[model samples]
Target chain A: MSSAARLSPSAPGLSGTGGHDDRKVPPVADMARIIGLSIPVACMPDVVANTALLHGYADLVGSFVLPDDCEPAYEYVP
Target chain B: MTMQGHKAGAALAIAADVRAGHRSAVSVVTDVIADIEARDTRFNSVTRILGPAAVAQAEEVDKAIAAGRDPGPLAGVPFGVKDLFDVRGEVTTAGSIVLRDNLPATRDAVVVERLRAAGAVPVATLNMDEFAYGFSTENAHTGTTRNPHDTARLAGGSSGGSAASVAAGLLPFTLGSDTNGSIRIPSSLCGVWGLKPTYGQMPLGGVYPFVASLDVVGPMADTVEDLRAVYAIMAGGAPVGEPDMGDVRVARLGGWFADNISTELRAGIDAVMAHLGQDRVIELPEVARARASAFLISAAEGGNLHLPRLRRRSMQYDPATRGRLMAGAMLPAATFVQAQRFRRWFRDHVHAALAQADVLVAPTTVGVAPRIDQPSIVVDGKTVSARANLGIFTQPVSLAGLPVLAAPLAVDGLPLGIQLIGAPGGEAKLFAVAAELQRAGLAACRPLEAGYARKDS
Candidate 1:
């Protein structure tokens, strides 16, 4: 709710952004485990911190809507 | 030949001489290799000089000319590739320690092979953001590629080395990849011609994959003609020649593309529009959302590519890229799906805007290159990291899958540029407008020394 909590990934009170996330964004530590279950404990901190930042950006993208008929731009001749 | 060392010579200048049999390709290669050795220390643009293999290729070109056979279109022109592109017998580092031990590529990237077939000698591998992930070429392993125009400033890249090398006049032309403005940002900062061709139009074979969907390789050069010529070969012969400029319907991009621009840059774009006699201005809807989609898609895709490696060697990546890829790898599928779908809608809007004009012009960067010590630009009056936010104008355009030529504006002081956007597969129309500006002296490549000369001491 406060500016500091919104910016800090470590803050537990950070809520869903733009009503796009059904659940509160995962805590940084939880995101690290979500990426690689067996990832080294030491690497988790960086992963969590990074994942938290990415989730912040993903929030911006999640707000936009597209029709289901719009196909992804995946190109390969084969 | 003087070799034009740091004089910001054009690739077309050398190709003309070699094509005419006036100068031996062998001699040109020898001199260029020697010149880069002599002059590249300042910019640190070149990572490794090809040496023996390049010399041998040059000799073959000389033999062809001596034997009365043509030496090809780019004959004897020395060029470089971003280290991510495979060069035969060289390890493609992609600016990381992670790939230092990977075996040498058995062959060249498809585009590299195309250039070689056209007689352009690949003399070296240039520096880049590790895994082509960062906007600044401040490679932790390879060292930051200092702007040749001013050693203390950022060159603005992932393709920093490619653009810097051209700006430094060490190479006439170079190859670089653009995902989220990699080529365009660096080209605009370093003041060279860079083309990010229509997405999926050019072959990506043998180049290291970053964001598979958005990644596109293109050429950077000191002259627009050379840029188009090299592109012709890369796109599979001579460009359908330059198109008629009179037929092009040009308009300046307004709204998101116009904010936070400097006065000099504003004048430069104003001059360009006046030169074209196009006073029209068009704005696309939801550009901010389009940029966000491009960003998320790139992160998710780039993260997925490096996920396996990160799981094993997370500590090895540049900390900046590591976190990004990790975040991307963990991005929810729903988010990625939303980004992709939004990409399609945003692209349609952009294309629809293009239907009214043959080309859309926007400032490549918010302003000039940022100083190295203070590596931030004032965007919308807030100082932000130049590395992450350099693509503000470019990222939105990338979503459209259109061809954009990064045209350096001939303004005073540090290098600045404008983006000339064309409709899908409309490279020729963009080239026509770019050529018209270059001819009118409104936009021209300002080599490093030329920019430094213009700098206020």
Candidate 2:
């Protein structure tokens, strides 16, 4: 078997990955805090569509029934 | 199907034992905790064990049973929740310290409520990648969730902990959310059965969102029957009644699903088909462009949701994830909008394709779990980003919001599974077909026993 067929404790890094070479960047103590809660990359369309869906729903329900948090630009609280 | 061996630790067995007065619910739950404590130290599958609450809940279940009330389907069975999901009285950490001070959730996520109603006890909040971002559960914040078969390798993520916990018998079944294959990848890596119901099959109210459209909640279990039981309760829809298994038909997806898979994966799929004596192979339409479109939408929306946080605390995320999110933030708005339009087009196209087949079959993941510390995957001698590789088979399906079940192939010794994709709202049919596969002995569904690991050379 080739060398790649053998198992290692930690898998090797990619053979040619040069786009972003910031491997030596300083580590942040609170990564989530620094990164902030970004929406998951997979859910963008759903969020946009859902926002529109909620907006359309709001028009029918009127202002009092909807929480201000339900507005078009409401940040998703995880 | 009558309790054949130790591998079949069915909820039915536990219930039977309790009804026969051999043990109490408290005893079963206490033993499950002991099992987790003893085994998890080696597996590191669980992030946090819910000791006190589980014990108290077990006692309450025992009391209800004593009062002669049937405690529903999962009565007194112990299970775990993916940490991203909120549990009342506990902070939904989503595998990061940023939410350490967040107040406890006031209500259980809808799935959690359903499980509780069925008398299943919550054993712990399992680990995951920070905010369920990565495919390999090598959470810089919480440490990686290791595969039960080989501690040195990854437990596929971002539902890595759920799969690991179940694979290690820490919980017989657990709930996980999938956005582009989190639930399925881990389940495949850990050698367990998992289902990602059609989008919105189970309520998504209390779970932390990854990609909202692609995100879905489902169960991961040792066997398809257990998965069926948990899924029935979790779906909160009237039980799919009894599945009509005899009439079930399996379709092998050609096009994208057939290409780009590891040789090992192809071998496994071939073995599953060969064992059945009835195999159908067809070419499927290419899905790469749609997959990329899904990725574009995931990035743009995710970046926008956390734009303020990204701006204020850019240094806090795992460098790998932060860089990706940053790229998303730079994505033009029109591209993001166009991706959605493309999703509609893709969904319509797939719907037309499915009209020719009841369900599409493909490998749940392109390959086995990568080593936990790896930064990328090498497929066909070409290396790809580890995150992107994990979403290979899952994204196209999730983009269309279709239902899929990742069924472990019993004949394969490695942790590999096959994806059975059904039309939207076809979870019931998916489960029935999975059950037939399980009964045929082509797929087996018992949790891996403790201390079972494949040693590396």
The per-model DockQ list reads 0.38, 0.05
> Where does candidate 1 clash, by residue pair?
B135-B157
Tell me the tens digit of each residue's lDDT in model 1 across B386-418.
887888899888877789999988776788999
DockQ of 2: 0.05
Clashes of each: 1, 17
lDDT of 2: 0.69
Candidate with top DockQ is 1
- Model 2 clash count equals 17
Tens-digit lDDT string for candidate 2 (B1-457): 1112233446655655555556677778877777778888877778887888888988888787788887766777778899988888899988877677889999899889988988888888898888777788877787878887778788889888899988776677888888888898898888788998887667888888767656788898877777878888887855676446555556687766776687777877776666545476654443654566556667766666657766666566765566556555555555555556556655666777777766678888777778766757765466766765777778777777888989877754567789988888777788877776777776765455632111112
Task: List candidate 2 segments past 4 Å from native.
Answer: A1-78, B1-9, B274-278, B282-286, B373-375, B450-457
TM-score of chain A of each: 0.49, 0.31
